[model samples]
Each structure stands twice: as C-alpha cells, then as structure tokens.
Target: MEASKVIHAIYTDDDVLMSAVKTVKAEKYHIEDVFTPFPVHGLDKAMGLAPTRLAITAFLYGAVGLAVATVMMNYIMIQDWPQDIGGKPSFSFLENMPAFVPIMFELTVFFSAHLMVITFYMRSKIWPFKKAENPDPRTTDDHFLMEIAVHNNEESLTNLLKDTGAVEINIVNKDEDAH
Candidate 1:
C-alpha cells in the first residue's frame, strides 16, 4: 500500500467532535474515519456516510424466523404427531396458533438480534482474534478521534482543526505506523 500522511484530531466532547466534523466537511476535506467511546447521534450524517440497511436486514431475518417457527410448529403439532390433548384432537395449525405465538415471537426476536449482530460483524470485518482498527486508545475511553488525509494542506487543516475545538492534533505517518 502506498504511504499517506493523515491528521488525527482528538476531541474531548462529542458536541465538539460533531461541530468539527461539520466544519471540516464544509471546507471540502474528506474525513476518513471517526472513533468515539460511544456512538454519537447523527455523526454518520455529518460524515456524509450512506444510511445503513441493517434495519431492513433485521426485518428480513425476523420474517424468516417467524416463518421457520410457523413451519416447525405446523409440522410438529399438526402434521407429524397430532396428539389428543385435553380431549381436543383438532389437527389444524390455525387452531393451535395461539400456543405457537410465544414461540414465533421468541424466534423472531432471537433471529433479528443474533443475525443482525453477525451481519454487523461480517460487514465491519470484525472477527475472532482480529486486531482493532482504532488509531488512538484514548478514543475507547473518553475521547473522540477524527482522521483526515493530508493532501499537501497539512498547515491549513491543522489550523482548521484547532479552530474547530480539537483538543490535540497529531500528524500520523501511515508507513511508519504500519510497523
């Protein structure tokens, strides 16, 4: 990979980071990434990132789970072994649906939550034993870090970050950091 210089701006407060993101974006500077201790509302919008489709995927997964539960219940209760419980031998799925509601709901929630987590991990390249991509360890605690590439405008970008309430700014040499 080609070496590139980047500026890392650290912010103590989320609000400061938010405003700094907007200001830097308004100046036509491309922000490569941002790391925060907690998720900042609307940070993706400020960074001009595309809206996530994870919700849609979750819904789809939930639907699949519901369907699986329905089919499984039908096969178990109505088709495979219809038991004469409480003297009611009705082998209809609809008739036994009330008993299946809890299962359906549980499976739906389970699939949505578990599958969404897996999808998020896969999409984010997060896997077992994977190294963290966070540039600054402080960002995992009480700081926010914004990384912007330097395109022969380090001085102007540094000055802008200072004006935008950056607590500290560091110029990172990507090649040196790789080692």
Candidate 2:
C-alpha cells in the first residue's frame, strides 16, 4: 500500500490544543486524529465528532440482563423445583420477585459494565496483544498530538500549526494499514 504524508503537531497544554483544533477546523483542514495523555473535555466536540451511543447500548444490555435474571429465577423457583419457605407455598414468579430484586439489579449492573467495556474496545479497534497505535510516547505522559493529512498544503498547515502554538511539528509518511 502507498504511504500517506501527514503532519503531526505536538502541543504542551490542552487549552492550546483545543484552540488549535478550532483554528485548524476553521482553516478547513481535516484532522486525522488527536492523542492526549488524559481525556480532554470538549475535545470531541471541537473535532466535530458525533455523539456516542454507548449509553443506549448499556441500557439495552441492562434490559437483557434483567430479562435473563427473571427467566432464570422463574425456572429455578417456580418451574423446575418449587420451594416453600417460611411456611408460604408460593410458586408464582411475581410473588417471589421481591427476593429476586437484588439478583436482578446486580446482574443488570454487571452486564452493562462488562458489555460496555467490550464494546468500547471493539469500536476503538483495540485488541489484546495489538501493537500500540500511538505515534509518540510523550502523549501518554503530558503531551498532545494532532495529526493532519498532507495534501499539498504542507507549508500552509505547518505555518498554521506553528501560529496556533504547536511546540513541535513533524511530517511523517504513514502506512494506511498501520492503524
């Protein structure tokens, strides 16, 4: 595959990075990616990314967990082997739902949390034993990096990034499959 040329702009502060993103966007330059040591609030918005649907998926997973808990409890308590506890011979699922509330709640939380984590990893193309996609290790400590594709505007883009307070800028050839 042919390699693509891109500009990497490194920033020291998140505030500078945020304004740089806005300025770059205003200049109609498409940003390929941004890497930060920690989550920067409003960075996604500054990059014009769409809202995430993880919350909806979490809700659906919780619903599924609740349904599974209900079905399992019903089969164990009412269908397979009925039990009379405290002299109450109740076999109805609704009648025993109060006691099942704790189990249902716990399963709901468990499913949502675990499934959301898996979904996030999958969506982000992150996998166990996969090579790191980060271009610079300093971003993992205290730097921010913004990648912009080069399309014969290298000179202007470099000038813009420098004007936006980029501490360092590098032009690199990146393989399309590297990500």
Candidate 3:
C-alpha cells in the first residue's frame, strides 16, 4: 500500500489553532490529530470526537473498591477477630459500619484513582520505556500542531491552513518500512 501523506500545520496560539480546526472541519477535511502545549477547552468537540467514557469506568472502580472494603472489614473485624470496645461486644459489620467509613472512603478513592490511571495508560497505548511518538518537540513547549491527512488536495489545504494563521506548514510522508 502507498504510504499516507499528512500535513502538520503549526500555530503559536491556541485560539488560532481552534479556529483553524473549525475551518478545516467545515471544509470536510479529515483531521488526524492535534497537539497543544496546554489543554484547550472544547477542542475535542471541534474535532468531532466522541465523549470519553472514563467517568463510568471510574464509578465502577469505586463501586468495586467499596464492596472490597466492606467484605475485608467484615471478615477482619467481625468474623476472624471480633473486638469489644466501650463495653460493647457487638460482632456485627452493620453495627460497626460507622468506624469503617474512613476506610471505605480511602479505598474507594485509591481504587478509582489508580485504576483510572492504568486504564488511561492502556487505552492511550503508553507504557514505561516506550519511545515518544511526537512529531515535533516544540509542540510540547509553546507550539500547537494540527495534523490533517492529505488526499491529493495539498495545495488547497496548505492555502486554507495559511489563511487560518499557521506559522509553519510541513508535509510529512510516513515511512513505508516503519509501518
């Protein structure tokens, strides 16, 4: 298969990039990706990306954590070694749920946070010792890059990007062997 050609349009300001994105979409061009130095609000919507489902996953993780906490606490404090405090020997998890509130809260937070990080990493295909895939290092500092696939309309696309205030435009060909 022939290697795909992509255009990288670099912008110095996020507002310009956002406007360029809207114009590109209006022209029915396919945007491969966009990189910004900092998060720009509503960029995903501009790119027509589906909403993220991380919040639902986080809620499920929190539920799992809460269930685990309840079971562990019940087994440790009620079944295995019941403790009597303040002249009350109530060996029941329900009666001692108040004391376990902090534990439940901590476990829920821990599970949700850690699992969400792992999920995001896996979903993003990021791992330790992985090589960076950034096309330009300047994008990490002060530049914004908008990547668009070229479909034999490079001249028009370049003109459109220039009109949208792109500071630099580069045409990149994917290395056939790399694929």
Best by TM-score: 2
lDDT string for model 3 (26-67, tens) is 999999999888999999999999999999999999999999
| TM-score, every prediction | 0.88, 0.94, 0.91
Give the least accurate 10-residue stretch of model 2, judged by summed lDDT: 170-179
The order by descending lDDT is 1, 2, 3
Model 3 clash pairs are none
lDDT scores for all predictions? Answer: 0.94, 0.93, 0.91
TM-score of 3: 0.91
Cα error, residue 122 of model 1, in Å, equals 2.1
For model 3, what is the error of residue 144's alpha carbon versus the real structure, in angstroms, after optimal superposition? 0.9
Number of backbone-clashing residue pairs for each candidate, in the order shown: 0, 0, 0
Please give the distance, in angstroms, between residue 3's alpha carbon in candidate 1 and its true position after superposition: 0.8
The superposed Cα distance between candidate 3 and the true structure at residue 7, in angstroms, equals 0.9
CA RMSD of each candidate after superposition:
1.9, 1.7, 1.7
Error of 3 at 31 (Å): 0.5
Query: In candidate 1, which residue pairs get closer than 3 Å at backbone N, Cα or C atoms, i.e. clash?
Result: none
Q: What is the lDDT of residue 84 in candidate 1?
A: 89
TM-score preference between candidates 2 and 3, better one:
2
Per residue, candidate 1 scores C-alpha lDDT tens digits across 96-133 of 88988999999999999999999999999999999998
RMSD in angstroms between candidate 1 and the native structure over all alpha carbons = 1.9
Residue 139 deviation, candidate 2, in Å? 0.4
